[model samples]
Target: MTDLLMNPTVARLTSRSLLGRKRTLLLSLLPLALLSLCTLARILGSLDDDIAGQLQGSLSADLLSTFGFAIMMPLLGLIAGTGSIGPEIDEGSIVYLLAKPLNRYTIVVTKLLVAIGVVTAFGALPVLAAGVILTGELGEIAVAFAIGAFAAGVGYAAVFLLLAVITRNAVVVGLIYALIWESLVGGLVPGAQTLSIQQWATAIIEKTLGYEAQLLFVESAVDFSTGLLALVGVTLVATAYAGRRLQTIRLHDES
Candidate 1:
């Protein structure tokens, strides 16, 4: 299994899919937009203490939660996760690999690793950079949010990878969950926050930054323990399930 996971062909395929022309362009856009926004804000000379506080307290927070985690991370994960398999499935090209003697689970794990890497690069790194730009590492907020983004990206990639295996509309489902469930319901309904990845991730950031900061960002329905457990559990389960699903996956006919 380890050998299969390390297969050069698998790595090659993963890299090609992740770095393909269209997807690469799409992935680059988010980080570029974030940096541009931060630069614009800086150039506008709106760095009054009050404004800086608001930028850190509200604007940066919203960007991390709404744009970074909710919009960008999930979208990137969907593209990476599903793109790892969806195109092969769609074009019936997966049969070439499946017919070989490689272990199915190995393939899944390799693809998951690639997806996780892609999400971290395109999603987490920008969040960290943006946080730094927003507050110059005040209270280690940048590091804290970056760590939260890392954890969230891992879970997001795993969940979306499973969704890709189980359904054709994985991207749509991921978008709905990221946008409607995490953003809308998680905000409007207090209880829904526990079930939200955004809240769980925010809880991590809160804990890392101390109680006051935690209280500021995380209105999670679940306690820290619950949120951590759910995040870890869901990621592991999704990866395992995706592996099992791949083992039995049937290739569709091109004809």
Candidate 2:
């Protein structure tokens, strides 16, 4: 089962390629920006204790939930996920890997795993750090949003990775989804929130913080049950479909 799910060689190669200097720099930019924002907010807040107190409450939560979860997480997921395999496919290097005696599903899973790790490290961890920087403590706001960031990271990675498998223009398509569907539409339209990964992850933060989430107005458009179900469902279904897509690509190449 483990062998079917992962290939060490594939994982190593995927990590090497994905974390090449250019990709690493791209991934680092967002997190650095996030932390810098948090630091600036904190510095400004320290000017007045009253301002600091107010900033620590709603402003901190907003930074963590709004910018961190809604914006940075999905964008990081898009970069890491698409970068994991899109370059190989685009450069026609995937054929070399596919020609080997390996399960296509295993290949997909291995790359997905690497993408998830990258998202977790670059996306989720930065949210956690930003939370601490903004809140100045490891409180409910920090912890809860950190967890939410992680959940969103997982969903985004899977969805974007699948997008890469299906389209050479995955980055452009993913930016539309991340910026349009998840950001603008999801934020403004109540009805569309049900279909949003950001809302689902916000639901998790709402659930984890419970009453505290309410105090900061950290609410999700969807309920916790719906959010959890959608998160798991999207990840599984997208990953399975990506494997199938890879198989089709292989058959076409053989022909």
Candidate 3:
């Protein structure tokens, strides 16, 4: 189990490389923007009686859901996911790493763990903070979105990490999936929502919020069961495939 699950060496190296100066700045940017927007909204709501009521009602929910869940979480997942192993593969450093006496699955799982941790810290925490700042309390609205962000973060990390393993153009493909497919098409097309990590998160948020979700108008194209199943299935399948792909990777020097 230990051999298949994680390696401290891989985890340490992946963390140091993934969270390097430039990538750290990039990861911090979205969270900073989220907190800034929440702070600004809090200030604006304070200045207006009607807006304050709305913030307590739905505006806060919209901000947390739309920007935090729909935008920031996926973006963070992409950066953390690809950064975990993409550079190593690209620069042929993966050859050295692979030459070690380690299971390929162990490497994938360790990197995936690091990616999930990064997303939890930079993605889920910010969403939670933004929700509290916007709503002025750690209520259902705040907690629900935070949980949803974490769930979505996990799914995105796995999926994007698989992309990195399979393609050098992981960033381009991930951006199109995040920006165009998930954000754009998922918004307009009803069927696409069922296939989206965003909507799966919405289902999670709705489930977590429960009756309060209705009050806040939280709705998802898919039900909680479908969403939960899809999230788990994708994460497992992607991680497994990535491990298999890594096992078969043809190193430049080997060729």
Clashing pairs in 3: none
User: Which runs of model 3 end up more than 4 angstroms from their true locations?
Assistant: 253-255
CA lDDT of each candidate?
0.76, 0.89, 0.91
Weakest 10 consecutive residues, lDDT, candidate 3? 246-255
Candidate 3's C-alpha lDDT?
0.91
Q: List the residue pairs that clash in candidate 2.
A: none
Q: Candidate 1 on 1-255: residue-level lDDT in tens?
A: 468666668878988988899999988998788777765654443646666666666566666666776667667777788888877776678888888898877787788888888888887888888877876564466677788888888888888888878776788897888778876887678878778777788778777777557434644566668778889999889988988888887666333
Please identify model 1 stretches exceeding 4 Å from their true place. Answer: 1-6, 45-49, 56-58, 253-255
Tens-place lDDT digits, model 3, residues 91-145: 9999889999999988999999999999999999888888889889988888899
Please, what are the lDDT tens digits per residue for candidate 2 over residues 1-255?
A: 898999999999999988999989999999999999999989988897876997678889887777887689889999988988888888888989999999999999999999999998898888888888888898888888889998999999999999998988899999999999998998779899999999999999899988887789888888999999999999999999999999887423422
lDDT score for residue 180 of model 3? 90
Off by over 4 Å in 2: 250-255
Of candidate 1, the 10-residue stretch with the lowest lDDT total is 211-220
